[model samples]
Target: MVQSASIQLENPQEWDLSDLYQSFDDPRLMQDLEALQQTAANFRDNYRGKVKDLSAEQVLDCLQQLEAISQQAGFLYAFPALIFAADTRNAEAKQMQDKVMEAVTGIENQLLFFDLELKSLDDQKFAELESASVLQPYQHYLYNIAKFRPYKLSEEVEQTRNQDSLTGRQAFINLRSLHLGEQEYDPVTTPDGKTCSTEAELSALLFHPDRDVRYEAYQSVRKVMQQHNSLYAYILNTVAQDHKLENQMRGYESTLQKQLLADEVSEPVFRAIMDGTKSRFDLWQRYYTLKGKALGQKIRTCDVYAPWGNDPVPPLSYQQGVDTLLAALSQFDVNYARRAEEFFLKNWVDAKVRPGKRGGAFCWYAHGKHSYLLLSYTEDYNSLFTLAHEMGHGLHFAWIGDRQSYFNSNPPMVLAEIASTFNELLLLDYLLKQAEDNPQLKQALITRQLEDQLNLLFRQSTVSRLELAIHDRVTQGSFDQSFVNEQWQSLYQDLCGEAVEVLPEHQVDWARIGHIYFKPFYCYQYTASNIVSLACYQKYREVGKDFIPGYMELLAAGGSLDQVKALRQYVDVDLENPATIAAALKYVEGLLDQLQATL
Candidate 1:
């Protein structure tokens, strides 16, 4: 069973934002909406048919104007959607979110002709526009658009595809989010002997210090899911089928191929990371054995996350956690520290738990203007780590906010995890050093850190491999319920090895991972990014002051460069190297050795 961390803050505040607009119903939103409609109309009127007649400079100006208009509207749409996610029960916010999504989708459809029309221009005309000064800033975007020239369909067909997407493929995603993805768990008696059954409460049970409670919580959650499996199976099958159909229509060779193309990463690089992780399954098996011994159990699936011994939950105040994060970040770069401090001072974080709030944590950046974080803060060591993790994402967005265009603003998921995981590594190392005087505390911290690494790195990689296999089988018309369950069980057993006993429900574990339903093959990036970040963290430790500038530059680069180029410039780590994964595993092994010796 997966227990959630505790969330006990009362009077939790929402994001205080007067930066983008005055309020949700502020005049500025209306003004932007009017301007967007006008500009989009004007763009269609001016450039819809005269692309061959316009000079390169004129074309660039038109593109820039369109980009600016789209970006402003994006900012307006994003904030409310983020706020709604933080509290799904907000009916008004939900309605506004749906309205904004429809508006944005309509606007996007209006601009869909711009690319196909541009691509239709003759070579000489296209070349002239590419060299225009006004368009130089967006040359990369233009170049990418041009790259799709060969794949371009007729303008009418493209428009139909664009419009159909919102109501067809995209609407299915919304349906899944609203219905199938909600995990309902049965109420369990808390330590105070009161029964509660909220998502937050069920999450807390996963980390329960008592093995029996953790097992019971796991069963209760799975039972609810088991009852809903048929519904979930329907959602999964439909989404996967939608993706397969779209990929075929888009001329993509495979589902993973589409993701790789979008991520700007090579299939070889992704496969390398998977292969490297498969080679290091023993590290996870060893760690689980140690964890099982520590918990005095023959490790059931629920015991994977069970607390070690009866150690008192280390109390971490919110301010203390912030200070700890600031101090650790200061070691790498002062700018990161300052940016994090600004988030707290400005109330950019909604850090309290309340009724009807969202279940998970995320950092939301609306048009690179400001970042908002949503989390239910609990005063525990893991909470501190979580704070740092989300703040890492916030800082990354903040650093690059001013510099990147909308198209280049968001990094790929594989690279996105680097900043967050790097923060975790820095905080863990800092805490380990601070606890050096207390051997037992140091051992416990080390164990906890290793547990996290196992989850994010090894275990997530295993899950990704299973997902890839499942998708591949589906493409070959071989996937079914039994096929998915068998593959899940195989991966779990492989990772656990002989060190632990796999429970029965654990066989259908893939059904519980929300990402597979929404984000196919996204879990592998968690493993890859952590491995890449370990190398980056090692550089920061070795080079000290010299590493700060490079680190800051990497964050500032955002999605301006592809993942490989960005990492190469920032940390000099090659994704193709098997040694990168080996190095990360070696670090994990060292931590385990230290814990074993000390404990």
Candidate 2:
């Protein structure tokens, strides 16, 4: 697959990692490792048992050293990860990724006493550090780690888990990638006589103007999934078991507790999202009903993405995609456009879907360094928006680099999404404005944009619901594919209600989702992010450019502030408020109304 993508004038499509390491075997990669190991050993020698007696000044010195070590370790590990993401088939990339993760874990194991003993500090000393002006930056970091104090294990046990990780959760994830990467969906000829084989190829056909093309590609993918569902089911079960076992050992109250803690979100926030999103199934049901009428037939799963009224939009080229994205960005903030220019000029993006590259798009950020975007671009509206979404992540990382140190540069997964989705919304608004003279074009564009938001919010929430339910059941015992399919279809019934029908073959979708298999309880952040971003966008409508500085402040704050507290102080959106979710749903409805007028 990996298309011919040159972005624009003299733009490169492959990343230049010389900035990180010259190549996979660069001598500096190992040198960085040796230095990191020495730093860890020396730090342990200096502070292993001395944590209890350290003054506030000494604590500041210890924090600085820890940050330096963590920063360098992050850079070393990020190198191979970025490489493997661009080309999963690269043997050397895979070796280096695994090697770095294993080595970094060893370094971290030596430094475990820093956090453990810090948390064990007497109440007075902990409070003194919390109030010290010099220690203000580390206050939130210190407070967050304190939450894990209850879950902390003996140093030996913690080290064992670190070493075991390569062969445990991460090992299963890698194996699943290897198994799924080479899968071949049968080739289906399009209505225009072009042939295709890859999943990305088949998926593109699913949105073709011709129904025959869409269904042929759809049925072909279903046949392929049927062949692999059992293996996927087994992989999921094994990983879920490991997850449950670890949570139990750590004394976590629930499967989702740690994830919520990591994001600094409360159970109430999650509950509000679930309640708010599920309550609006009627919105999706109505949209599907309208879509079915637009197609002049029943709305099956395959027909959902199909274009209506036979007005096939012209395809965009890679160069055209770049131009459209930057133009839209410039409309909101030329500064963003300026930052985005580097993605093309510096080869910061790997956009073509070559053989065995990871299946989806992500912006991998290296702390204190730059970010690289791995995307599968096909020169369509969806692909264009994907470029914007990931570039949002790239932009966020770049904007935060100079403002926050390495440890604080990464925002929570929830706030991490604000930049990406907000970028998508800006492009959507720009496209909507351009099509205003032609109602037909306007309707189509609005429907497309709303559908993307709906997918991000509603469908992503359903994904998390399925994970929660599956994990609950797995804790009871292992389940077969039939059981897994039933759980998936039941959730479909919940989301679609009595109106929409999910194909039996599509029931195995639970197998194909990569997030749950790799990072359990992760998908809900998409739902949460969309809700929060839309709320932030609502603010933008009130004050325009006046909102940009405050928004920029949140991104720069990163993990330096509490996730919800940052939202409250900077953007004035309270995540725990159910009304926030309702506001996002109302936004969806307004778009649906616009689409209805065209119908």
Candidate 3:
């Protein structure tokens, strides 16, 4: 039954994309594309085969030109992408996104030879070039290319793969987007006979205090996935197989090596996170058991997000949410809060819950420009945290844009997640302090924090494990619907243990994970970054104001320095150590103790 909880409603909230471009018909869009194509052609004509022979000053000139071209291309793509994300059902936006992608690919094909030539540079020549003072500015960029030397193919073959991706991997990715965008599920009927239509609306119900509503919403959404399981399975198989074939051709020994190479994370560190998460599955189980005790009912998969205590979640308006978030940031640093306010003032966030908008929240960094955030806000407590999380990403990119060039602005996913998750911890701290005198509210806030950790740490690793199993299965033979379902169920069940019932519908839940299809092996980074964020947050708690300088510097460093070095230098956290992961779990255990005392 729908409880008497009143949802906070306000004026319609939307963002302005005029900063990206006036509209799809904007002449600057086409002019930029044309300019990009010509620049790439001129660049290729100048530097295609001369990378090894160029002087250090000449190499610097080439890189600067390439950086300018890359930035413009990124701007072109961001316009349509932000549009499509705002309303995936917009036909014009879809067409524009597709058109921009093809054009960008052509530009990339033209510029491919420059990188291939750099990769082809022999060790002595590469070292000699690196020693030159003129090339010092791009030392990391030069080193990055050098590491991929073994993976470089002939220019002809590389160009062919680049062009084919339009119809190959990218096509499958697009199909998934369009499928989810255009496909509507059966309406979820609330106890009051109110019917909710879009996936975002259905997802909002999963947090309802009423058990029946959550289960119905869960079943309604999964049933649709079950009906289209075959197509999803095919899409997953095709994309994974393409990844596998490409990895094999690129001389990578395993599917994950390519990502690790890009992420700068070592194999031991990856295993430490995954293995540590599995070893501590009791943390997950214990949390669910605690949840059941607090709710005074048995926990189920559908009730994972249910509110605790007697009171339903209070109605938090969008502006109220922003105020709370900014207050939290202001307590941390006025500069941080000031930067975040610009996002709201500039109309850079799309927070309305509308049909066909993407389900999850993401902050898209527009390279040289400011960041844009997108999310379907349900005007609830959880929505507030989602806002803070993405705002963390926005602030991180803002710092990067102020300090780093285009070549150095892209932080690895692991590092990128720290800034975002740290913001979440800050918000949690602020909320818990406000609820200090109210034991039930404290317990509720603590439960939310714990559950988010479980999702970020354990659940993400489970997703990672399922991804690995599926990729392995594809290598052995093509997998059908049953195989994918069983893998997800087995991994998920292991994580759940006996604490929560895994409904039959939960077996097809893998299809709902866009990351698996969009970027395989991407979920584990959440777990990895959670550890670092916790450590950073822990330091902030202990040192108070003293921790601000290094932390701010860490954010400002962006991708210019090595991530491991950056963490160690600024935050004094080491990613390679098993102790870091153990410290994070121990902190989680402390939260469990607090929750138990409240009960």
| lDDT accuracy of residue 514 in candidate 1 | 71
TM-score of model 1 (CA atoms): 0.91
Compared with the true structure, all predictions reach lDDT values of 0.74, 0.82, 0.87
* Model 1 stretches with alpha carbons more than 4 Å out: 1-12, 17-31, 52-54, 120-136, 180-184, 192-196, 476-483
Q: Worst 10-residue stretch by lDDT in candidate 1?
A: 1-10
Which candidate ranks first by lDDT, i.e. highest? 3
Candidate 3 lDDT score at position 150 = 90
TM-score of 2: 0.95
TM-score of each: 0.91, 0.95, 0.97
Question: For candidate 3, lDDT tens digit of each residue in 1-599?
Answer: 11112323264268898977999889999998998899899998877777889988888888889889988898999999999998889999999999999999999999998888888888988898888998876788877888899998998899899988999998998898888888777887877687888888788888887788888888888988998999999999999899889988899877788888998899999999999989999999999998888778888888899988666667677877887788888889888888888787778889987888877889998888989999887777788889999999999999999988888898888899998999999888888898879876777788899999989889999999998898888778788889999989888899999999888889999898999988878999999999999999999989999999999899988888889999999999999999999999999999889878767
User: With candidate 2 superimposed using the best TM-score fit, by how many Å does residue 394's alpha carbon deviate from the native?
Assistant: 1.1
1 or 2, greater by TM-score: 2
**CA RMSD of all predictions:** 4.2, 2.9, 3.7
The positional error of residue 574 in candidate 2, measured at the CA in angstroms, is 1.7
**Candidate 3: stretches off by over 4 Å:** 1-9, 191-194
Can you give the lDDT of residue 520 in candidate 3? 77
Leading candidate by TM-score: 3
Q: How many clashing residue pairs, candidate 3?
A: 0
